[model samples]
Target: MRSMHSMRIASFRVQNYKCFVDTGEIKLTPGFNVFIGRNDAGKSALMEALSLRHTHNPHRSLETVRTPTSEPPSSAPTSVAYDLSPEELRQHLTALASFFLPTGPNASASVFATFRSLLETGDRFNADWANGVVVKADLAGLGGLRRDANRYASVLNLAHPSDVQLALQNEITGSYSSYGVVLANWLRDKAYAFRAERLGLGRCAAGPDKVLSPNAQNLAAVLNVLSSSNPARYKRLVEHVRIVFPHISGITSVIVEGSSVEARVWSIPLESERSDLSVPLNQSGTGIGQVLAILYVVVTSDLPSVILIDEPQSFLHPGAVRKLLEILRSYSQHQYIITTHSPTLITLTENDQLFAVRRQEGTNVSTVALIDPNRQDDLRMSLADVGVRLGDVFGADAILWVEGKTEETCFPELLRQLTKTPLHGVQILGVDSTDELGAKNAQRVFEIYSRLAGTASLLPPAVAFILDKEQRSETEIANIERMGRGMVRWLPFRMYENYLLQSACIANLLNAEDASSGKAVSSEDVQAWMERHGGEKKYFAPREPTAYSDADWPQHVHGAKLLHDLFNEFTDARVSYDKVKHGVLLTRQLLPNPSGALSELCKILDELIRGAPSYTE
Candidate 1:
């Protein structure tokens, strides 16, 4: 299933599509084009237009148009002068409407003619929409003809009404259009909008993989087909996948019952692993299913060069997200249009790749604008003079770039509760998980902050950062302070988990769920676990390998690793703990009874809600 040749969508233009009012045209780079926006701002609608393409019937187009409820049509003229038989009227209307359907030599006149073709009682159009309505199917079909009609209207604006009508008729019937041929070809063509995105991938199944749908629902069948028929493609995919899941040596799909194929990964043992180890690829981890689906599409499809993916980072960790991105970068032949809501994912991209999506003011319509990531534009330069950075130009008012998912996950809930005030325009981003390079963190902070911060204030509270302290040296801390200028912050504790260890935080979480709901760690038990782990005596939480009796250890969530393992349950269908979710749940639990453990966090959160406090105060 090797692609015939590399293809890319040069550009896409929408006329009357959803949430788009004549979004003239937008060019896309051949490599990766990132579409970033706030929720409800039309990213989904845009993908709909891209997926459906400019093909649906005229009635569909009219129905999907961005119509306001306030303004209804005054009236529609149904009768075209003389009284005629039902057959005559239907023939006449259908013919007139036929011109509206993808008019060109390649168009399908039958498609336009037959749309909502049957009238009730052989006289009425459709029994389904037969109720009282100003405009009927025939008239509704006229919507797509506006462009062609307007051309004639422009030329004959001054002519007599009868003459103008005759002229318009002459223009329509006189000029030849090859719409049917073009449309017929398009319907038969495979080269168009190609899509593979973050769609519902149910629990692992050995379902028939005969064909891969938008979400790769038939992943088993897809992999089986490729592995059997196209080994080269399969091998190529496995190699790329190995970069993310180093444990996998190769992928094998076996035919199961009912045309479904079972898929498994031949994993390399942690040490010199055995070939006998096989894991269900889908059930192995939190995001492997989606990652495999995406990679599989690239390997085994006759895809149009214009590839569309919406929220590709869903279910993937920060590290996994980076690997998926790396794969996308390698496929330079296809033009990629990707939508995302992760700060970590955004940092992986450049300014040129970023496009800001927003709703047009006071309208349901939405528009996407190119963002200058390099900060090299005239307007951006002028803003810098006033202390605004290019990065601040489009994103949220406040951004806290942290070290990893645990930090990315927990802080927002704590802050959201602590701030009390709603945070509509703030963002908490996780850049990475490791803490190897202190200097690099400082540099990235300076680079990103210079672009994202809007105010020259010592602490530009609107847009800032929070990275792990990671036991940084005094010198490193001072350097970071110089760059962050009090705006960027590092945890006073070892990591985000250290904050969770706060006595109040512990009591709050362990109490949220009682043994009745499930099982909850008790405060007394937590204290015992702490003393047992020597956490009360140690300045920082125990790292790992405690000598405490495994039997005596607290029976609830305690210890950094235990806490992580509790949250690291990615595949438990009943439970899900990720950076994005659970935080809200945790926040609700902690809010009613505030925690002193988060006091230091409160001040930083306050800076975001209300600008930095006066030092004199």
Candidate 2:
């Protein structure tokens, strides 16, 4: 595997923390990384440690340094004992700092264990960005109340000089009078970590200043700001969300009768018509919104933070899962640590960064980098050796099919440029079309390709037939469509017809001198030729025309162009056998799957050609 950039955990070690008893260290890649483990595997615990949350109890004592005492100092030339040198002491401190720095923007800052714990709870919190302080308190603490009976209390009571309050509170017991002034001041300055969840849109805590609650209910206000002040940017964000959910045709923000702002998705019909099936954002599928929210945070946030997610793929459909993985992989440019049960995501990319977290007995947790290059290669090879196809292992994956040695030659390169999607299970097969068989022979080629695809259980891309459209009688044309029925698709113009039409267009555009000089030919002459040869001129014309007269062309050209134009219009297009064998070779390139309609046409053509007499009449 090729290394892109270097990012290291710097000083990550775990001993007697969570499930890890033996200390373990892991290196991190600079890009998107995946952590995989089964249930109860302590993966989350491992993430917490890396995030600077204390993995061990804070009460544990550090062993004090001892120095050797000089014996018989007076007699032994005043030998003296000393502790570790200042340099050694500095080295130890540097090691400690490295453990928390994390090799990024926040690597130098000291992380607070108390703040980390306070973040786990559902509440509002503040982080003093200026002072590097995190003040977290319960909802009640933010308000000016310390009533033990009130369900909603305030963090106001926590404000104070700690040593003085400790002494005073011990003496005063339940009285707030003595602690009032100190509690209020301390409460005003303390900060907290708010988990990004509980903050939906309405929850607000009364205090001097609330750090934008990561999970406080103030999220609604943020959304409101985005929707109103920067609607265009908000729309762009929503569009990014839509690419993952292609079925969601449009999303509009609306306030329901209850006056709550909500985002709704409108469904689009397969035929391009609109329908009303607007679902509220909150009520929408969890997977869609979860994936969207994660993306939104990664893109929108400015904080130097690592997002720790559990079961990121929950409720996500396979296709959506694939899309989500793509987005996540792209977002790896930022820092995020996600846990999932999805093998699809785990193996989504060959260069994915992976780590495995394992829990051991007696508070021992271990995390080891699982994205080793050699091991990944071994895993892939072992799978192939075991007769396991990647598609089978990964489910009915998408595939591209290219026909013939020529297509097999350059298809991958062309596809990479066109789609930008990674090629996973695409296969190339030769249909053996070199023989002098007519266009109907495409059925045989399709059968060979389809059978191989079927055996492999790889769903072919909408069939893109690269066969030529040949000259044929009505019976023969129908025979080809029948032959290709479900396997082949139609290409525009017969092979010779498309070239001749293009030739005619060039011929028409130039005058007699240009035509005679081989610079151009008479379009009218080509037009007249089609009229005499029982073909359509306008439909078969190579150049785009300002006007088309359907009545001017004959049956052969008209009928051929009709088939050609139909395939062009069809979504998920497949190619017809006739198109491949004889149609103008369209750019000498083939797409993955043509349209599904084309697939059906190919099947129909196959049946037609199979039953037709081998000896042409």
Error of 1 at 495 (Å): 34
| Per-residue lDDT over 1-617 for candidate 2, one digit per residue giving the tens place of the 0 to 100 score | 11212111212344443444433444444444566666666665555444433323321112111234422111101010111122222222232211111111221122222222222332221211111112222221233322232121112212232211111111112223212222222322211221223223332222222123333233333455566666776676666666567567665554445545555556754255443466655666656545555555655643223345665545655545555555555455444456654455544233346665544344334444464644747444323322333332233133222334333333333333333432322233324423321223555555544565557543444233444444345675566566555545444334323322333332332332133343333556545544444333465455333223343232135444644443333211333323432232331222243334333433443333223222110
Task: Give the per-residue Cα lDDT of candidate 1 at 469.
Answer: 58
CA deviation > 4 Å runs, candidate 2: 1-11, 48-213, 216-219, 252-265, 268-277, 302-305, 330-332, 347-351, 358-367, 376-397, 401-617
lDDT of 1: 0.48
| TM-score of model number 2 | 0.41
Model 1 residue-pair collision total? 24
Models 1 onward score TM values of: 0.40, 0.41
Task: Give candidate 2's whole-model lDDT.
Answer: 0.38
Candidate 1 residue-wise lDDT at 111 = 31
Tens digits of per-residue lDDT for model 1, 1-617: 11123334445555444465545556666567777766677776666555543333221223343365443222211111111123333333332323333222322343334332422112211100101121212222333442331222111212342221111222232433333222222222222333333333433355434446654566776677777777888888887777666556777777556645567777764365453577665556646666777676665555333456666545654445555665665555545677765444453222126667777667676777776643447324323222333233233434456665555555654554465433333445555532322225556656555664455633224345676655466787778778777766666544554444434455455445332445555567655655554333233333343333443222222335544444333123233333323343454456667556566577776665444221110
> What's the lDDT for all of these models?
0.48, 0.38
